[model samples]
Target: MNCEATKCQCGCDQETDQQKYEKIAEIIAKYKNQAGSLIQVLHAAQNIYGYLPLELQRFIAAGMDKPLAEVSGVITFYSFFSTQPKGKHTIRVCMGTACYVRGGKKLVDRLEDILKVQVGETTEDRKYTLDIARCIGACGLAPAMMIDDVVYKQVNPDKLETILAKY
Candidate 1:
């Protein structure tokens, strides 16, 4: 999405960088002086700006009076936190023991081929980001995959394209 172009990737009016900062600042103020509020602040920040870039992380560190290392540490420590921009839809393939044994790797390979993006990367059009999950607790549904929050059970490589089209 081009922030300077007036509309977001979804064609909605885009929020300026300054406006995003203001919102982040408000989030910081709301949680300031409260112990163990950094996670909440970071979550709000990521939601407001999509991802936590270094510059924004610095801004957050300064606003919350936290060391940059501390803020960055939290981001790195959490798998859910991303330092790069994410796609409109996130596709996570389950790679647990059951899923992997049932052809999880095939799913990953097919996605990489179709999306033209490796794991942990987003498509050029930002339509999707490919990822892997250790487990989604759907062992009974081995070879499962998830798009956004929807779980697809017993998925095979051949079914990926049709499933993705739904998004």
Candidate 2:
């Protein structure tokens, strides 16, 4: 799932906001004429643009020949779709039973305290985003968290400063 492209395959890195809108128009044009392509087109749009804001939602709805309300409904119903922007780096703290029992919740609290950003929020500097994951499939490394793509195992409050400092 890694992209080695010099341009950054996510497209969020190279494109300015305006340029992203331009590419979004092309994405819409490519799939808009087809039937039952709303979800797929939206996926591509999200990939290119990072997240779907209200205006972006309206654009996509209009492009796909869908009602704005319907598009909004679909986005809100799906956890995979974000209505806000993400940060350059994302941190996911596991909240599953295993992780929670091992101080994962404390880690979440400490993150909020340290970053002054709550779960599901991006830091003011836009360097980091905080998220809560049900599980990161690392029960063996309970109290684990993932920052960007790096997993930190057996994390504790004492290690938070050191871990975050690496970024």
Candidate 3:
């Protein structure tokens, strides 16, 4: 693959579409006959391709000798599987009771405005994907937010910009 044309999330080296398919095919061959291995295969596919698009899902279905509906159903059933490409970084704003009462809605609104993308949408530049979380278990620090795995406590609209800049 031309690294100059498309860069993978890992930022090491990008594989051509053909190479990606071959790798996934090999994975399918490894576990095709294993009962209840669809989820595992899907997980590996997502890890390699980033997100499970309809086309890739179709390919996987055919390779695994499963119906498209079964594959699509699994993808939809799991929130972790995404049909669209995700941004390099994911930002989740907590919206639990404590957070909501502590200006979580305000933070969501501010993030929408700042990122120019609504909840579950990625920025145009693909730098960030915005999401809403029920809670991040930081009730004591209400209005908490997380960028990837790092949680920010007592987040406020005023600090959103600075927090985003660090990313």
Q: Which should have the higher lDDT, number 1 or number 2?
A: 1
Better of 2 and 3 by lDDT: 3
| Tens-place lDDT digits, model 2, residues 25-78 | 999999977888888878888999899999999888888889999999888888
Candidate 3 residues 1-167, lDDT tens each? Answer: 23443345557767856668788999999999999999999999999888898999999999999999999999999998888889999999999999999999999999999999999889999999999999788999998999999999998799899999997
**TM-score, structure 3 vs. true:** 0.87
User: TM-score for model 2?
Assistant: 0.87
RMSD of each: 2.7, 5.3, 3.0
**TM-score result, candidate 1:** 0.85
- Identify the leading candidate in terms of lDDT: 1
Estimate the lDDT of model 3.
0.91
User: How do the residues 1-167 of candidate 1 rate in per-residue lDDT, one tens digit apiece?
Assistant: 35664335555667877788889999999998999999999999999999999999999999889999999999999988899889999999999999999999999999999999999999999999999999999999999989999999999788889988888
Cα error, residue 25 of model 1, in Å, equals 0.5
